[model samples]
Target: MKYQEFFSITIEHSYFSGGPADLIVYPEEKTRKLLEKQGFLLKRTGTGIKVLLPMRDNNRVFPVLTADDLFAFHVLPTSGTVREFTDISEIEEDNMILFTNEGLDIGTIELIKSETVKEEVFQNFPALAKIEIKGNQITTDVIGTPPVYKAIFDSKSIKWKYYLLSKSGATDIAVETRGDQLQFNELEIGNNSLDPIITSLRLNFPDTKIAVFESSVAIPLSSKSIKDIKLIQRDSVTQTDSILMKHLPNPSIYDQGIQIIKIK
Candidate 1:
């Protein structure tokens, strides 16, 4: 099974902005032919396999499908532009706002994650020349007179698990602007605390807010993000007033008590 990404866009279409129209998907020659022969209108763009939905709600999620699975596509008049998703990692803290296809910028949305952040050094960000990743840290350099950029991701299992447990207790996660990106490390669940890794961007920028989430009806659960596999716990850890589920090959390890199992 393969997972495909899809974005939900809502629009109150009008003559000024754009008229209502169906969405086009599956632009590939072979795929389009197959789908067309099967009585379906579809297309794919250079960026990705198009699977457009009618404008209604605003949200983002990667859709899952098998290679042979065909998505129902309704071909309609192509209207409006796309505010392009630059990358899955991070974007300019300010540009994270919800924007319209026709250059309409809404107010900033909450930060998706407390770990990743990026910013421009000067007027026009230069093209990337090289990128190097070491462990949980990433280093990138642009073509000519631009400063180096750095990003840090916590790979340690115990620390981040503990951090999530701590932050879930009706507290706003605070990730301050240390150098260029947001950094935080007090995520330890063991007797010997692990060291926190903080990376920096050489340029100077204003301090941005990266919080956990707004205090509301949101309920936190002991689940890991599909993008990150480091949060999977194979062993038991101390939990004062929290829930921890085992996500290992051998489930229900707690019933067997703590064992000295080796990992590769």
Candidate 2:
């Protein structure tokens, strides 16, 4: 069986400073089909929900940042006077907004509202022959500028397991057993001593051949059944209080009790 990835999104749409629509609008049929093609399946009746399934083990996913490019239907009626410019020079002479459908400014709506040219505005523009604009004339030779496209991947979510153990009472330790090894992933001691916890764990799991303790505790157990005690400590030397757990197949032999070797 595979686990489901659950997520939710809330969208507030506005255009031209109009108040947002009162009702929550569902995605159009075409948009839903596009998302389905990209492995995002939406609910049959719900809004702003996607049901993700684990199709592969290492599959990664991210969240969409902006929906500014998504299409929406709009209705407006207007009439404008038509004028023609004979050449690029004529258009530049007017000092009007230089608009383009193909080169450099594709997919963006830029309004050249002022003569005060901003350097960053043209940072990605086709290189200019000259930087200075003389008397409403762009004194730059035109080059074959390519269209600009940008994609950003900024957010991702991972599945994790967390346990919040209270420190005021018994230390909470979580472990997994495979074969003869008892592997602990996390151990939190609030106010209790490590000795009682290890003693209880040994009694509870008497058949465990090897005790793998992943935490700050280096306290050796009294039970001889635990022949090999592997302590996961951050440094080679044990701290006054702390535990770490890294795995190893063959444990070292030490007559003094618990053996700790820092991972190289």
TM-score winner? 2
Which TM-score value belongs to model 2?
0.18
For candidate 1, write residues 34-122 as lDDT tens digits. Answer: 44453332234432233332222443222233435332121222432211111212445443212111211222111112222232222
Q: Assess each prediction's global lDDT (C-alpha) against the native.
A: 0.24, 0.28
Residue-wise C-alpha lDDT for candidate 2, range 105-134, written one tens digit per residue: 323322122222222212233211111111
Superposed by TM-score, candidate 2 places the C-alpha of residue 21 at a distance from the truth, in angstroms, of: 11
Candidate 2, clashing residue pairs?
A: 167-190, 214-245, 215-243, 215-244, 216-242, 216-243, 217-242, 232-244
Where is the poorest 10-residue window by lDDT in model 2?
73-82
Mark the regions of model 2 whose C-alpha exceeds 4 Å error after superposition: 1-8, 11-22, 44-47, 51-55, 61-264
Candidate 2: C-alpha lDDT: 0.28
Judged by lDDT, which candidate is best? 2
Distance from true location, Cα of 57 in model 2, Å? 1.9
